[model samples]
Target: MLLISTQNITVKLKYYFNNNGQHYFQRSIPRALQRFYGDKKIVRHKLPSIHSQMLLEMNRLAHHYDQHFKALKSGQGGTPSQIQEQAVALLASHGVLPGAANTPARVPEGMYEYPHLDYIEDYLRDKKQAGTMTKVDELAQLLLSKPMPILLSQATDVYFENHEHGTSEKFKKNTLKRWKNIYDVTGGDIALADVTREMARRYIKHRLTTVKTTTVERELKTIRAVINSVIKEKSLNLSNKFERLTIPKKGKDSVARKPFSQDEYRKLIAGCVSKADEIRVLILICCLTGVRPSEAAGLRREDVYLDDEYPHFDVVEYGGRTLKTKNSVRKVPLIPAAAKVLAQYLETHTDSVVFPRYCDGNEVLGDNVSGATNRYIASLGISKTLYSARHTVKTLLDQAGTPEYLAESIGGWGKPSISRGYGDGHSLARKYAALQKALTTVLVNESE
Candidate 1:
C-alpha cells in the first residue's frame, strides 16, 4: 500500500500482480472493513496482459477502489459528481468520457444521425428482433431529452400537497426536516434533474460524517420517494436522484436502544416513588401499559376509566388531538402498579388533562415530558431514558413469549389484522392478560 509518486500521477504497484502468466489487479479492502465486504477481504480484478496498458488501467482501478474503500469506512454512497470529475480528470485514460460510447470504442451517437430510410428499417428490425429496442429508447430519452426546469423545492411542495395529502403534522414535519437536509446542501434552486447522483452521494457522505448511516439512509429514501411521486405526477422524463444508490449498512458494533435491566428498572421505580413527579407517572404508565409517552401524557380525564372492569385508559383521537399513527388509537388496560400511583396522582388535581405540565389540552407536548424525565433518570445515575420504559415492555413481552399479533395489538403497533377487515380487535381482557404476563415475568420477580 506504499505510494510511488511520479510527475503528476502516483501509481501503487502493489495492486498489479501476475499469476501463472495471467495478469490480475488486486487490492485489500482493509482488516477493520472486511465484515462489510463479507468474505471478500481482498478485491481482485483482471488486468490487460500488456505492461503499459496494465499500468494505466491499474491507476484508474486504484482510484476507484480507494474511493470505494473510503466510502465503506465512512458510509458514503457513490454519486454522479465524483464520476464526472473523474471523467474531466482522466478523459485521456478513458479515451472518451465514461458512458459516452456504448462499446469499448466509440459508437455512432445515433442511428437517426445517419437516417437513410433503408438503413433505418434494417436497424429497427435488428433492434426489435433482438428485443433491445425498448432499452435503447429508454436510454435515448434519458440521455437526450432536456428536462423541464422544475425546482427541487417546487416538486417537494407539490409532493406533500398531492401525494402525502392526509399524513399527520408529525409526518409532514419529519419529512420536511429530512428534505431540508438536501435542500440546504444543494440550495432550493437545484432542479430535480440537476440534483444529480453525485449530489446524493455527497449528501450521504456529508451526513454520514455527523449522523449514523441509518439516519442518512432514511433521509435519502424520503428524497427518493418525493422525487418518484413528482415524476409520476408531472410525468417528468427524468431519473430519480436518490434511485439506485447504495448507502452502507450500520456497523455490527453500532449502539442500539436497549430496555432497562432489572437493576435499572428498580432504580427507575425507586426514583418514581421518591420523586412522586407527574413525569415519573408518565414513565411508569408507559412502562406498565406499553403506551407511547405522548399517549400517556396526552390522556384526558374522559380517556381514563379507573372504575372499568379492567381499569383501562382509552387513546381515542377526539377533539383536536393527534396520535403518532392511527393504530396508536386504542385502549390499554391499566396495570396495578401504574394504577396505584396514577389513581392517587389524579385524585385532587381536577385539570382535564392528566399531565398538564407536559400537555396543553389536546396538544400534548410529550417531548417536554421526555426531556424532563430523561434528566430525572440521568440524575439518579441511571443511563436509561424515559422512552426506554416502552422498549422495556416490548422486550419483557418478547421474553415471556407473547404472540406476535397479540404483542402488536397490546402495543397498538403496525397495521390492522387481516382477519375479515378487523372487528373490535383483541378484547380488553386478552390484551391485559398478555401484558400482565410480561410484567409479571419482569416486575413481579423484581419487586419481590
Candidate 2:
C-alpha cells in the first residue's frame, strides 16, 4: 500500500502497489507547495506491477511538471493555453502523455534539457577523461573581463615606481616612453585577451624598420615583462603571449661600440682645459675604475673611503638611485689615477655629493656631465663617447692578462657565476693588485 497526500491541502490520494513482495509509495510535490497543487489530480500510469525505482522516477517527473504548471497558472511563465501546450509537449517527450505509446516522442531540434541524474553521471565520467578543460574555460572567461591596455598601463606604473628594487626617475621616464610607443603601435584600445601572436609579430616588424635589432629586442622584452607582471599579480592562468619571441642576437644588425686606444684616450684627456674641471675628473674615474658615468656622477661624500689603506667607493642603490644588477652593488677599488683625482676634488668639495653641479634635485647624476664630456672629446677630433672610457678600461685589463673573474669584478660586467657567489668576491688586495698591473701597462698621465 502507498499513501500520498498534498500536506493539509485540498488534494490527497491513496495508492496500492507491489514490487518484489514490497509496497511502493510517492508524492508529486512537498508540503510547502501542496496549496498550489490543491484539487489537481496527478496523472496516473497504469502499467505492469510498478517497481520501486519506476515509481520514484515517476514521482520526480510529476513534481517537475507540477512546478512548471504552477508558474504558468500564476502568470509568471506565459498564458494558460501556451503553458498547457508546453506541458503536454514535455509529457509527450518523456512518454508520459495519456494514451501515448511506450516509446518517447522525438524532441524538436535546437532544444535540450539539463541532464537527468543518469545523463549527469555519464557526462561527469567523460569530463574526467578530458583533463583541465573545465579549469581552462574558467580562466579564459576571467581573462576576457579585463583588457590588456589597462593591465599594461598599471604594470608600467608599478614597474617605474619600483624598478631595480627602488625608484629610478630616469628609468621611469624611459619605460613610460616605451609604453607609449607600444600603445601607438598596437592601437592601445585592443583587449589583452584578444592580443594574438600575429599582432605581436607585426609590432616587432614595425619596430625593426626604424630601430636596431638590440633596441627592438629591448622594447619587446619590456612589453613581455609588463604582461608577465600583470599575469602574476592577478593570478591569471594564461601564458604570456610576448614571451619566447625570437629576437636577433647581439651585434646582429648594429656595430659594437669601440674602445678608445691608449693614444686616443691620452690625447683626449690632454685636451681638457683645466684639470680641476669635474668632467676631467669624471672621465679619469671611468677610465681607471670602469664605473658607469651615472655611478660616478651619483657618488656621495660617504661613498668614498679614501682614508682606508685600500681606498674604495660603494656602488649601491640609495633612495632615488639604483644599481643595474645585484652584482653591480659592489665596492669599486680606486686605482692610483682614480684615487688621485678623487682626492684632489674632495679637498675643496664641501657638499655631501662628490659632484654637486650635476645633482639637479633629481638623482640622475651623469647626463649633463656625459653630454659635456662627449662634446669635449668630439671637439678634440676623437670619435668616441664618454662610455668609451669603460670599454678602454676593460681592454687595458685584458691586455694586462688580468683573469676574467677579476676583470668582471672591476668592470661589473656579466652575471654573477656560481664560484663568484661564494664569499665577498676576490679581496680588495687582489683586485688592487690587478688594477695596478692593468693601469701601469696603460697608464695615463694624471698631470695632463
lDDT of 2 by residue, 116-169 (tens): 222323433465677543432222223322322333445675555445632666
Q: Estimate the lDDT of model 2.
A: 0.62
lDDT of 2 at 20: 59
Q: Model 1, 309-399: lDDT tens per residue?
A: 7889898775445777888877788877667778998985889999899777846665587788788889888887777877888888888
What is the lDDT of every predicted structure here?
A: 0.68, 0.62
TM-score of 1: 0.57
Candidate 1 colliding pairs: 79-198, 80-197, 80-198, 81-198
Query: Which residue segments of model 2 deviate by more than 4 Å?
Result: 1-155, 158-168, 234-239, 248-251, 360-362, 415-426, 441-448
Among all windows of 10 consecutive residues in model 2, the one with the lowest summed lDDT is: 136-145
Please estimate how well model 1 matches the true structure, expressed as its whole-model Cα lDDT: 0.68
